[model samples]
Target chain A: MLRQLEDRYVHGLINKSVQGFLISNHGNDAWVEIARMANLPPQGFESMLTYPDSMTDKVLDGACTYVGCTRASLMEDIGMFLVTHPDLEAVRRLMRFGGPTFEDFVLSLDEVHDRACLAVPELTLPKISLNDTGVGQYVITTQWQVVGAISLVSGVLRAMADDYGALVVLDVGPHLHSDGRIMETLSVFIAEPEFAAGRSFSLAERLA
Target chain B: MTSTVSLGFDALDGLMPMHILIDKLGVIMHAGPTAVRLRPEHDLLGMRLFDVLTCVRPACDGGFEDFRQVIGQPLKLQFRAAPHTRLRGLLHPLDDGQLLLNLSLGYSVVEAVSDYALTSRDFSHCDPTVEMLFLIEAKSAALSESKKLNARLDEAREAAQTQAETDALTGLHNRRAMDQRLCDMTQSRRRTEFGLMHLDLDFFKQVNDTHGHAAGDHVLLKVASILREETRANDLVARVGGDEFVLIFPDCTDVTLLDTIAARIIARLEEPIPFGSKQCRISASIGTTISSLYSEPDPDRMLSDADTALYQSKNAGRARHTLFKDAFEADDMVAH
Candidate 1:
């Protein structure tokens, strides 16, 4: 999420990801219905632009209603889609740059926002803080304008764990902070570091 | 502790994965595991170091002492292989007068990676090359997405422009489009002779007043199709008013041709159009003028002259065509 001088705005990349997830997982007709329900044009979101925060909220709500799921789950699905979709392999590669292993990636959570900003300067992802509670457990927290930021992070973590052949469980919930800002908390536990043989990753891509 | 410590080959290999050890004769004694992967088909143990790598900077000869002179200085070298991958490295002196050269693929890391099919394991964990590769992929992806956005916006803009220039009810060129075409043809540097015709429906008001606006709309649609059928692909036919249409024919200034076109259009309009169960009857009056008739072609004057001839046809009795020159002469005859 990134805003201009005054008004809060969400980048079109996020909305476009939502649209891509819905259209590819569901169908184009489902996306059309959701867009119509959201009072948006059937053309859907453009990935290089920006829209008002209210419009994003409406689209999320409309998608939740259409998909018969909670908004958090939909956002989580979108996060996984961003990583797993072949069309968005660049996102997966970027997340892989966090570290070599899933545990290293979890430790690099606090730097995710800075790394993303460096990659795409306008995309100001939420800042995350992680606390290593025990040998295989961690507590992650963040305050963002978007309600599903933590849920999306959980989904990305889950997908990355699979990418690295690790097994992890994730739990997410929202709580009110003393400063009156709504903050989300995600609890993570690594069940098995070596769950399965992971997909092989090369530092450089081969041209066909 | 000893004043000078000796390092083992395994320790050096682990510390610098791309390091190469050369003897006093400039022959490679040992290469790090990652360095050996560069020339997998050829063993580097007995090969001349200068034969495999050519020094690109610091102006050095392919000799042992020349390598010794540039030990701590910055070095640029290139592989003498097909891809000619470039390398940056530093050289240090060993206790046995051998050279320990640690190499890194400078900007050619991308090419070398793809050429060698190297993975993250090929470099040390502290290496930033993988992160750089990630940034490159991310930026390119973002750039491609923006390019798509630009293309889509351009398409949307062109569609909006076309919609703005079209008449909603009949899907023909609107008045704005007609005016633009008229101005363009009249003011063009390579002005070509063209015929302008102004036409008005003869009994359209009576049909609208009798059968209601729906029947009028049906008759107008039929009229539009007839006009389209009567025009060439390059000809301009526009709905400029409720009951008026303007047609421009480029390179068509012959009066007889204009008259024939007008007659065919009038005959087509005279046919009854059925809206539901009611047959709506309508006719048309046409006036013609040519750009060659005026000393300097002007859009406003031509339209006004065509309108004057159309009104003359209306007064002379409906469903007839009147040439502007003929109407002007007829007015002269009346004044005399």
Candidate 2:
């Protein structure tokens, strides 16, 4: 992502999420091996710092080699982890605020980047543009500095469809452009709005 | 140009689920759907409006005339029942000679919602209350995440700093840390005094040549333990080189105490350190200087003086201690 920006730096929050996904799912030994493979310090990435974009790429590449998975699958897992992890329930709750139904959430994709900016001013999410072709169909285009974001968006959309009890099929298209800013396309098809009962949500949480 | 649009009771109830309507005689004619749920134990119709709600604001009496005085103005009311839920609204005089009061939970919306087990369906669609709730939840969650991030960042920073200032091989303060401490003590505004020592191993190279680097590491570790054991907790000990160390005792200007400590360290080092089947033997020569010897102690001068005294110990013989002042006096005698 930093290749397109003047600073050429990726925020540590993104790197930390990758680190967290590796450690929690693959264990600390795996994370240690991957960090060592990437020539990172023993303490691994800190969540509040920034690193070179090349370093982020190196870590992701190292993770792919160590975990024995493709880059697209790994990015997708990280996306699902952010939305569905027990420790990150706050993230799921915030997403639920997109609207009452899954279709509302899809239509509100364009505003997701701005809403995220309002929450954390430093965060740089991909700018999403949704093209509604027909009923329950959308051509979602995401523009960002990094290429893997489209795969991640597909993962999030899949999880959110389940969250809203909407059965949907998602197909991730390849990168449309590779220069300047990377852009990718996704096709979404909602099969059933009420496929199953979803988890309940309340406006007022019973905070302990 | 003004027109009046009449709404049916059901339509009014659907629009404002918490409204209250009273006749000219201050009798409760109708209560909105949600208002009826506030006090489900008692029926609302035919009861005096003032009997169920206490007008806590505007100093209104329990009469239609008093209510009319505050018409078109904001009203603050509380349920006369137990748990006295507070409500904020405005009182308006209807054209049919009655009073209409539409109410909503104000700042206490969260607690009121929980207290009543209210859901989104209970409020009108146009109400901003649900949006307010969403914002509150989202901001709190973001605040928590930011705090966790901050905490982890702080931990990482401290760990990095500790690693930077620590010697990886000996687990002792490195030269950088020692230099910082010395600079701090000398540059302090207070009349701070301390005793500094320069100690070098007598035959560490021989041990490495005789055995191997592993044996040499074992001996160094033993020497570090001896130094730590002989010094006080507040004292600073650093490995400035492969076989050279620096020790600083803050607020300690007694040359005799420092000499005793130096002798103890050398004696402990002389004890043979066992490595595999071979016992590695080593000793230490130390030079001491007290900060009180200089008018304004400078780290560079103090270090040089200690080094000069250490060389004196080396010249006199190995495995001994020398004071900078004593070395100077001996030089004076040699000149004579």
Candidate 3:
């Protein structure tokens, strides 16, 4: 995982969750305490682009313990946080330009991840593929995962759909593959008919 | 008889037996009644054995077959019984191609009680492993803290030693440090040839009386800088007294080199140093002594000889260098 991503999540927690909680909530030392709980050296999380995935996982676990939240909930909150965080404004803009409608953006998650890989070359992002099962129903499969934060992807999709004003219903599952790959599949049903129709309309408009 | 045995087994279930039964295909065949009661969130029946428990010892390699190979042997395994609870246990095999995992709490009882909010009655009172873990952790933390403090103390001590040896105003070696250096060099087994030059500022008292002590300090600092600039890299310049300095040149035997250095220092000190508004003029009278010419070269004797030569230069004409050997030859002529 990228330290830039870790830094964003830590800053988000300090500003949002850890605010008014610590007695001496002054500087980065509070975050350093969280890192210490995770069995990392003090001041270990420097401004590097990539770090060991295991260390990041421990740090996230430590953050959850500090905030009195479960791992699943913390991942969801971090995903939601990244959407609106000013430091990640470029990422939000990139997600917006993925497609015109919410369905297009959801379907083009793999492309967005591919672009993300350009920024952090060592990132082992999940491969996302969308298969249209039926009318307004799409099966999104995320495979070849490294870090166990698939819940964060679900939270990000939820926030993205809300941003585009598209109503979406999601059914999430950890469908294990025969090759030992844990594929997180999300069956999304776009409730808004206009948003479903706008996917093709926006694509046509772009083609014109 | 069968009913009586079943009733006895059901009674024993209240004691919380820490064991699990898994099939060769890595599926949980059955869980002990105690294990079930402790880990309610985990549905042990039909769940993947590797998903519920991790093999820590004997090297399971995360493969079902690898884990199956170590079923008969005693092995350590970790079970994800609960979110906060850490379960470690030994694995044994049953006769019917099933594995039995005997479990226990993995962390210190003190930590477990605080973190999981459990009472002391919940744990076995005689388990020394918990106490040992706490002791080891405390010892490790103390060792690391001490190591950090020692590192900081070492840095402070080094800085203090440097400050003690350095002159505050001119940033040159002080008299005490120079004496130590001379002592060390004289006592060395393979003592190389060396030269010492004693320099005293001429008309320095007049400048201090007329221009004030601040101007005199400025002139001394300027003279220190000139002596340092004229000397070689291997040479040492020390402020030994007020308006008095000494230069020690190691591995130097040539008299001409010493003459050149002395002349350069005297010439450089002749230039007027700028005080606040007016300029303070000063000159230096230097005396030279070589260690190679003396039998049993001694630092104290060399210093005394250099001082005598400096007095002769001061008495003759100021702003000149007098060799100790020349003074000795003049004394010999008088005795003849």
What DockQ results do all the predictions give, each relative to the true complex? 0.62, 0.32, 0.01
Can you rank all candidates by TM-score, best first? 1, 2, 3
Backbone clashes for every candidate come to 0, 0, 0
- Residue A42 lDDT, candidate 3, scale 0-100: 59
The sequence of per-residue lDDT tens digits that candidate 1 reaches over residues B52-169 is 8878898776776788889898999988877788999899988888888999999998889989988777877677777778778777878888889899889999999999999999
Candidate 3 wrong stretches, greater than 4 Å: A1-208, B1-148, B190-192, B294-296
Model 3 interface root-mean-square deviation: 25.5
* Tens digits of lDDT, candidate 3, B1-336: 434222233433334354666786778766665466455536788888778777777767577878767755756666555454556666665556666666676653344444444422233334444334333443443345456657777988999988898888898999888898788778759676789889998989999999998888888778877887888777889998888899899999688988887888788788878898888888989888999878788889999999988887888898999888987886688799
After superposition, the stretches of candidate 1 with alpha carbons farther than 4 Å from their true spots are: A1-7, A24-37, A65-68, A178-181, A206-208, B1-16, B21-24, B56-76, B88-102
lDDT of 1 by residue, A1-208 (tens): 2234313667788789888999999899999999998888998998878787778888889889988999889988988998899988878877886777789889888988777767777666767999888988999997666778888898898889989999998888665553433488999999999899987777666322
Q: When only chain A is evaluated, what TM-score does every model earn?
A: 0.90, 0.91, 0.70
**How far does residue B31 in candidate 2 sit from its true spot (Å)?**
3.9
Q: Write the per-residue lDDT of candidate 2 for residues B1-336, one digit (tens) a residue.
A: 889999999999999998889898888888887787676635578888888888889877677677778888888988887768989978888888888989989987888887786766678877878667766776665566678878887998999999999988888899999989988898857647999999999999999999999999999999888889899999999999999999999999888888888998999899999999999999988888999999889998999999989999999998999999998898889999
